[model samples]
Target: MLQKFGFTQYESQVYEAIFAQDQPLDATSIVNYSNVPKAKIYEVLNRLIDKGTVLTTMHGKKKLYMAVDLQSIILKIRADFEKDIEELKTYKIKRTFTDEHIWTLKDASSIASNIEQLIEEADSSILFLAWNEQMDKYRELLEQKEAEGVHVEVLAVGGLQSSLTHKYSLIPMIEDSKLEPSQLIIVDYAYLLFAGIEHDSWKAIKTTSKPIVKALTDYFYHDVALTQITKKYGDQLLQDEEIARLLARLIY
Candidate 1:
């Protein structure tokens, strides 16, 4: 554990030997307790001092070394880790194009975890289309993202009540329509995730491909438009012969 933070074996031994004592120890005593070679003890002490893991002081004419407190070292390590993480968050790689790979996630657990991560990564907007059960699975995550100022819009099937801005799917009104419920989500226009239940198991695929993302985003937008149009002109649109014919040609 001590070596994990860049401590050499000799330095770690010397520090532990000194830390086990109630007071600081001189070079000779440190070498005796740590089993470090006499020739290497001073070098180890100097390195530990440079790392701020050990301190030095004079007791009369003899210099003594002491290990820093364990809690202090832990706090310093935590601070360094946090600083690195913050710096990493600001870094952006310059890439001319996105990778064209679509990753498949098998099983319900994998899909659920991936969707949760995508929702958490969303910084701007989340466009969702899903049935009640699928919507319920991620409803809290979507709500939390919305509270963090991410725009969440949903096109929901069945009667799933949520605080998000959503439109009801017309498939539910078809009465005779037999459509299996599925989930589609686009996050920040960068990620697309689609999943459905098959044979009582979940199958999902995710991608950052530009064409796929744009196609699905357009699909969600068109669905939203259709829902609004149907709500506004339900009877009138059905009465129009041409519109009725077009509606009949649509796949339920």
Candidate 2:
């Protein structure tokens, strides 16, 4: 069990003996009992004492040694381990929520390639909203998926009127709406991609988590009515949506 926590052999033996003993024993007694060298016993005892696994007392002219509160030591170790595990879980949650994987691309070609990879890996469906400029690169991939009988729903803004004439199905949102240059694609509720475009910078983030992806998908679905009306009338009707009405009812 000690080895499982990366304890060395000598350390494990010394600790085990100390833990098993009913009372503390001097180095000589420990040497006799443990069959470790007398010279090595002092070193081991000192280390154990420093680790709070043993204690020392004065016995007449010489110092007597004893194992410290073994139960307390074990409890402390268990509590520390539990704390460490909790911290690790919290860090994992933060990493998943932040979508820790990031990629920086310098040009449109790289961006197109990355988006294509996301599409190819998608297993269920693709949910996309973007501007007309970026659509050209994804157009062939989208059409290919449609040819393969995969469902694709795109919400595009600006100048899709002419391009909307094609056989491929498309959904139009408000014209010149803030194009979601920030791309998000969730696949099979298991994988996710979030891409962003700034004035001169571009980045993509990826993650895979069933629970988180499902939660995000559910949140979107839960607010679908609000999302549709918001897209239709822009942010000006913030006070008129069903969600707003519910909040108002609660507040009043």
Candidate 3:
């Protein structure tokens, strides 16, 4: 485990051995307990001390070494990692050119993270369509954006019980959906992310392409409109044979 944090093998062994001891140990004692080569024991101890993972004390003419407190070391590591992340963020370049390429994203976690990022970056509005679970996952974020004056709208697969002004409709138009479960999101009229299960795996495509974004935006608008219309005239539409046939042909 210490090696994962960049500890050398001998340094890790020495530290563990010292930590396991009740008191500080001399180099010979550490080598005996850690089973590290006697020739390399002092070298490893010095490196560990330099790294602040080990401390030294002078007892008479003898130098003794002890492992630093585990919690202190862990906290230091975490602080360093966070500092690096903040510094890395400052290096991000603002793009001057329009990137119209569609990029594929795989797995549920990846898709969710990307969507959350897009939502967080929205300066104007967020238009989303997804299942109830997704709506639940992002409802707080959407509400936050709404509070910040971003026009937030959601079309949930289940119910429209949220603070955002939106619509909801069940997939009754298709009797049996052979299509995979999917989600749609448009952010600031610029970013578009469309995701669905494909071959039993989560797959998504994201893009900033103007044409594609406009096309999907229209699709989302029509979907919301249809859902609103269905909520009002659903029974009547289902009652008509011709309308029912056309509705049955409509699939995601």
Q: For model 3, name the residue pairs that clash.
A: none
- RMSD, each candidate, Å? 5.1, 17.8, 5.4
Residues 1-252, candidate 2: write the lDDT tens digits. Answer: 666665556666777776678776666777777777777877877777777767788787777777656578778788889999877643521123644344456565666666776676555576554555666557677767656666665544332433222222123332334433555556556566556766757666556656656765664343344445545754465456775555322201
Off by over 4 Å in 1: 4-8, 35-56, 68-96, 133-150, 166-179, 229-252
Once fitted onto the true fold, the runs of candidate 2 whose alpha carbons sit more than 4 angstroms away are 1-108, 159-180, 215-227, 230-252
Task: Give the Cα error of residue 58 in candidate 3, in Å.
Answer: 16
Ranking by TM-score: 3, 1, 2
Decoy 3 TM-score against native: 0.66
The superposed Cα distance between candidate 3 and the true structure at residue 118, in angstroms, equals 0.7
Cα lDDT tens digits for candidate 1, 104-172: 877888887778777877889999888777778888888888988998888876656777765365545
Backbone atom clashes (below 3 Å) for every candidate = 0, 2, 0
Model-by-model lDDT, in order? Answer: 0.82, 0.58, 0.83
In candidate 2, which residue pairs clash? 24-66, 24-67
Query: What is the C-alpha local distance difference test score of candidate 3?
Result: 0.83
Candidate 1, overall lDDT? 0.82
Per-model TM-score versus the true fold:
0.66, 0.40, 0.66
